[model samples]
Target: MIFPTQYSMLSTEALKSYLEEAYGLNNLGCKLLIHNVSDTYLLAGVDDKYIFKLYRDSHRKLDEIKAEVELLNILKENGAKISYPVTDLKGGQIQSFNAAEGIRNGVLFSFAEGKPTHDYYDSRLQTIGREMAHIHNITADIELQNPRKVYDVRTTLIQPLEYIKSEFTELPEEYAWLQSTTEKVVEKIRHFDLSKFSYGYCHYDFLPHNFHFDEHDNITFFDFDFAGKGLLANDMMTFYVHFFFQVMLKKQSQEEADKNFQTFISAYRQVRAVSEEELAAIPYLGFAFWVFFLEFYQLHFEDWSNTFYNLRFKKERMGWIRNWVEWYCRF
Candidate 1:
């Protein structure tokens, strides 16, 4: 009898063979691209490339995986520029593999042309804003048959704080600071007129890495791993975080980053109505983003980021959360 395993890495060669047979494609090659919360592989054929993502049972269940496929299909059908799932010979979008950790699901996605860029020229900023607004228009008021998370004060702020408390047993002061700041954030959000906000399925991670711009400057958005129900402004908030980091690292002046963000907002307004109230709440919401990811790192440390998740990393994350509060939050 074999010992039970917690997690396992699938063989690239076996995956290549399986995919070729399942999709009826010849001359296929597979290589692991990323191994974070999920495993991503780059698949290349004679003339085309594709991405295959294998999901962990602990991260996304079958139902949530189906929801992602459904969402991307809808977006593609509506002409939203995105990297959607590709069907196999049986017209199936999902493939299952029995790994050491039990049943794992995988999906092959259409390759998004071009590469990701950090330098967002004015024209590119406008493109991002317009594209994001177009996605929001479709995601808003739509319901998925499968379950997905909802980002709220409980999930992003309160619950994450609770989940990470055990991990901070050795750092009491930092944990206390986190609790104190969360209270301030919750109170500040309490005063907002949330009814003015547009609710939708937001791509929680809208950083430059999740999108690509081709030679002709056309953009295609991918990686819906963290898509969930939330304020549509949450997408804008994630994009804004890119600029915040630029200013923090001294790569761009605060004034310049702010101006660039404004350019994006203005373009977004051209397509959809965004209120001053929702915009004002971005800084507070940004706090939730940090806290949520901090908890995420702690939760998946053993499985994904074991090499980097240490005491020093925790303290560094605490500093980031602190900086976010001092630089952006009020009260």
Candidate 2:
């Protein structure tokens, strides 16, 4: 389904062979344990750790990955606890390899030990909020060269609409509704004055899966593959839309949703206060995120539906967009 290139290409035997060749482990009695996280490859051995990210799409460039590594290195240098990119003995930021499938570009990194933030307490959310603010503060002054813009709501919606219209046939009724809804949302988004919002480099996708928390409640952010220049409000809104709206609010009552939103916003505002104007923009951003979700799901639905595990959840996958649009209009 969501098979990343590295995971699909490198099997257990292949990993062992590669490690044995790369690290001269032929004589040494060691085993390579490969961890298959969604969309990335991670391997752990007796005394070594490495993360391998496969270049699945052409949207990301090698230079952009280098920029992300530099940004993380800078964050670590500034006292933020993060996984630093590991260089080979010959000193290189990134290592390139040619597999039979395609060019697999990757950077090795030492693993940062922690669990995902979902297992942590609500107090830990406050700590995460503060730490995220600190990260933003540190990065605000550092100017990046030729940074690409992360995929936003507008592009996410429009691109897929064109794709579905051109490629897909025998349209399902629900998909037809999605297409119509996207057009309406696009009109609303275009009317909004986006120039009034503040823009900066941000971690475009900050979900619980992308963050880690230690025993002491220290939060470390990771997965900068989607990081880029964008509106800070949209960045924050993306997190809210993913965690609260999609995960929690969808399953619970409106009262529960409002409570959780207040908690997150309160904690976030303690470090950086969002203005009234930005607060008003949250609903529109939420609507945009709905479009984004629909587009992403439409692109991946076929592959995902074919997978054994993902097939079970296929029916519920793209149903949230309608409720999201309704909520946005009411708000």
Candidate 3:
């Protein structure tokens, strides 16, 4: 018997054959695009293209996967520009594969046209803001049959620290700093009038890399894997993270970053109402974003990217968090 395998890479050829049969496509080509928590594949045909994402059971269970599909369908129906899932001939949106580790789920999405752009000119910033607001308009207060993850203090701040404590055994000072900073963020958020905050489903990872801009300058957002129920401000906070990195890397000055972000905020306000208080809460919310991903990286180290999560990465990540706190947070 094959030794109990924890993770397995599905054969690209087998997947191509299976998808051709499953979707009734001809002359298809399948190649691995990314091998992260969930595996991504690029499927090309003579006339069209599609993205196939295979979810790891450990990363996203079937229920959560269904929730993601359901959310995408709703967004598509409501005219949000997203790379929605394609249905098979049998009217099924999800495909189940029996792998060495057990059953894995996959979905085929209409390929988002064009490429991701790093430069956020005024037009692109406006487009990003409007598009994000469009999504928020649809996702706000929406309910799904299957539940996705919920972002809150417990899940994003407290639990992440708990999950990553063991990894910081050798660097107790860093861990302690994280702990104290998390407490400060939690307290600050608690003091806010959260009842006035816009409540909704959020694409919690709204970074530039998750979207593409076509030649026509139209945007198509994809990779809703980390979407969940949370404050709508969480989405804005995530987008702000893009600017934070730009400033951190010295690609742009703080003034340029803030100006760009303000441009996005202005465009967003044209579509939806955002409270000043919610805007003020971004720093605290951004802290949770970093901490949550730190735990995610630590948790998925073995299967996600073992080499990328070594001691050096941990120290670098800690530095990032510290910088975030110092630059953004008062306490």
Candidate 4:
């Protein structure tokens, strides 16, 4: 049987039992944090805290999950402030259990203190840019123990078009236009000069929400579930589009978004040199990211009757996609 987000909820008592028995932690309270791609639970412990992430069996393969664990460890060793995975009593990083949806996997992580935000000052954005570059520089030489999915056109573009077409026999009038636009974007970016571009594992979802900052203005990035091998420029584009969306959502002007983008890119350039050729390919990559992001949500959540998933809301979301894609594609 399918479950919501392909995972089951754990009671506080059950969570405590699991932690005490396997991970050897005192879970004073367990609260379901968020359910986006996975069911993340906040496991409160005595004098400390931790995050319990239950992987949706259908979301990622075992190897990919293992890769994520290893990636985090490498980043931590290399001086990135990452929330590393905690091993169980059996000295295993992953724990599998049968849920209604089927057998699912879970991992424990040390809670990274501080709250994430969509807004940040120039100094904070500068810090984020440098920190992200540090991640790329450090992980450039480290090899993963297990393989993870590589971000590319087939995984991000064409497959999404096919999935949407197959899933819905009748779609909005603009759906066809979206498909063709995605195809054009794919064709345009099919041949890019990788010599000037940096390619490595990315936080893929390197947005403001996935990060938090302490009082010293130090930032910590979490939720690397979407992390994988891809163009570093794509990560930068993803960051741009997210802030751009915020601009649209808040009814702010493009001028504000432009400033934010420049602030981010300028700071990023200081840490990692981005050539004109690679930076030129960023717009189309942003468009492709728009498609992949949309497909990710649509494919995962089939039902849209909820307030945020209603027909009108879906249309509004598509509108944002259309506008954002056009906005960047124009330049």
Candidate 5:
């Protein structure tokens, strides 16, 4: 399968060759499945199920991969209802392959049995809350051997502003708005004390897409690519901000949005209750989180030439930012 952009370093032939060579399979029935334009993921059908994830860029280091493997294994050992990395017969979790293209890393994982929860399920939400809380509880005491770097909100906001001013001058209106809004956001973030919040190993990137729901509505979380040491509130804000943008913003009525938001918050609070101070900080951090994702897409757009960021989705995200900023200012 050809990758969508030039930045993607992995080629189909290279990946296939590496897999065949690594597993010593003469002929393996492998099909490319769920290639997220940003990352190449393949689901090869072996005697059992296995997933091969090919890193598209060099931004991720081997150490990060090892941390994820170790963290997942730890969670699995603690009975967290999450999938762990599959080991080869030799009992190796990671396999390094040197192909002509580059040294790409790949890992195998047992096929997690479940579907993504598209709509809200109370039990599933409760389970997710409890599981996430349990994960935090387990990792809170254990020091991260290789903690990933913290994502700076100010840096995230500034990069896009610079890019728009230096690179894309065509969309004058959008660029102007982005610049002004980024300035205001930067000002707001400067006064906020993020260090005061509780810090620990957070999922960092939990969304409906990353979760799997079994027939019994049990949610199993996956894809710990962005897992690292960060503020617990930051992780919660990230998840809430995404859900607000993707689900709440689309609702036609205020009641509908409020109801959905309450359900999510209620479920979340049940497992890990947020303090009043944390609740107050949500509006600010929520805006900061939106800025992070906004810049995240901008970084992708600049790095990957063929990326389509879904303009409508971005507009909705900006709406969330504007509303949160307004709400915070009033309070």
Candidate 6:
């Protein structure tokens, strides 16, 4: 709901037509899923069930979206566990249309069954780790036909700050403090010798919500909306940063945090090697992304026009971000 002027949820009628026009399916039912990053609609008809995604803010280009679909196919073909994209009637995987904002593209994906993990456990952490390793193993070698963004210090850290400045012509003192802290954090990030580390396709957003577990406990990774080229270790660090802070927010013990980290790292190493140096840099990388996320919510949602700015909604988040930063800098 942040950028309503630039983005709107896809209506049922339009969503159905999109499915029909692209995949030649009719009488499909549509349900609006969450609206963030993209507007996703769940569609169902007779024997067909699919999840349709409409890119928001036109943040991604058509070729970038195609690269995601292609990567999904590549991972599946290589025997990596993933929910692949469904081809349209024209054998095309993406459907682009002119909307109010501009040209928007949508893709039909086979529904991934199973609930997103909310209760953190070591076993689930290990599962996510192993699957990501499997994905990186194949994605590293495969050459993508379409281009994707690269996740690096510039993209993940500096660009977010630049976007913030664009939105807030005059930075608040809190925002100014954040800027100074971010630069110091960026310096810490620069210390990492990325040349010797793992590199290739990183699931820039490997948060737990992007994948689901089936009845057999097998994970089917979906939502490559943020897929891009980068250091694979960065993917692990992203998850590490997110999961750690989430647990801290819940008042969980360090033991619980340590257990999840140990299991996840150990399981990933079972499938692929992570060097000691890469392991050490995880906390720094995690902090970099953590700062990036804080800047993201502020830049995107702090204005009165953004519903996310409502005091009640943003209060706890600011507290959490502050505490996380203090803890990170202290350690």
Model 1 spans with C-alpha error above 4 angstroms: none
What ranking emerges by lDDT with the best candidate at the front? 3, 1, 4, 6, 5, 2
The residue pairs in collision within model 2 are: none
Over 1-331, each residue of candidate 1 has an lDDT whose tens digit, in order, gives: 5578867899999999999999987887899999889999999978989999999999999999999999999999998999999999999999999898799999999999999998899999999999999999999958989888899999999999999999899999999998998998999988998877899899999999999999999999999999999999899999989988898899999899999999999999988889999999999999999999988998888789788988999888778778878988878
TM-score per prediction, in order, is 0.98, 0.76, 0.98, 0.89, 0.78, 0.86
Which clashing pairs does model 1 show? Answer: none
TM-score head-to-head 2 vs 5, winner: 5
Write candidate 5's Cα lDDT for 1-331 as tens digits.
5334434345666666666666554454555665552354554554555567655444567777878788888888888777678766566777775544456566766667778855665565567667776776666656656546565564446654575354335456656766676676667656666666566777767777778888878777777777777667666666665555544456434455456555665766766665656655566666555655555565556554325666665565556666766645433
Clashes of each: 0, 0, 0, 1, 0, 0
When summed lDDT is taken over every stretch of 10 residues in candidate 4, the lowest stretch is 302-311
Q: List where candidate 2 sits over 4 angstroms from the true fold.
A: 1-8, 11-39, 45-48, 57-59, 117-120, 139-143, 166-176, 242-252, 293-315
Over 234-273, each residue of candidate 4 has an lDDT whose tens digit, in order, gives: 7787788777877777755778777877787788788777
lDDT of candidate 2 over 174-277, digit per residue (tens): 56776777677667656667676656677767777777777877676777776777667766676666555544345656766566656666787787766667
The per-residue C-alpha lDDT of model 4 at residue 57 equals 66
Scored by Cα lDDT, where does model 2 land? 0.61
Candidate of highest lDDT: 3
Query: 4 or 6: which has the higher TM-score?
Result: 4
Model 6 lowest lDDT segment of ten: 302-311
- Alpha carbon lDDT of each predicted model: 0.92, 0.61, 0.93, 0.76, 0.63, 0.75
- 242-283 in candidate 3: lDDT tens per residue? 888999999999999999999999999999999999999999
**Ten residues in a row with the worst lDDT in model 1?**
1-10
lDDT of 4: 0.76
State the displacement of the C-alpha of residue 207, model 1, in Å, after optimal TM-score superposition: 0.5
Residue 217 Cα positional deviation in candidate 2, in Å, after optimal superposition: 1.7
Count: clashes, candidate 4: 1
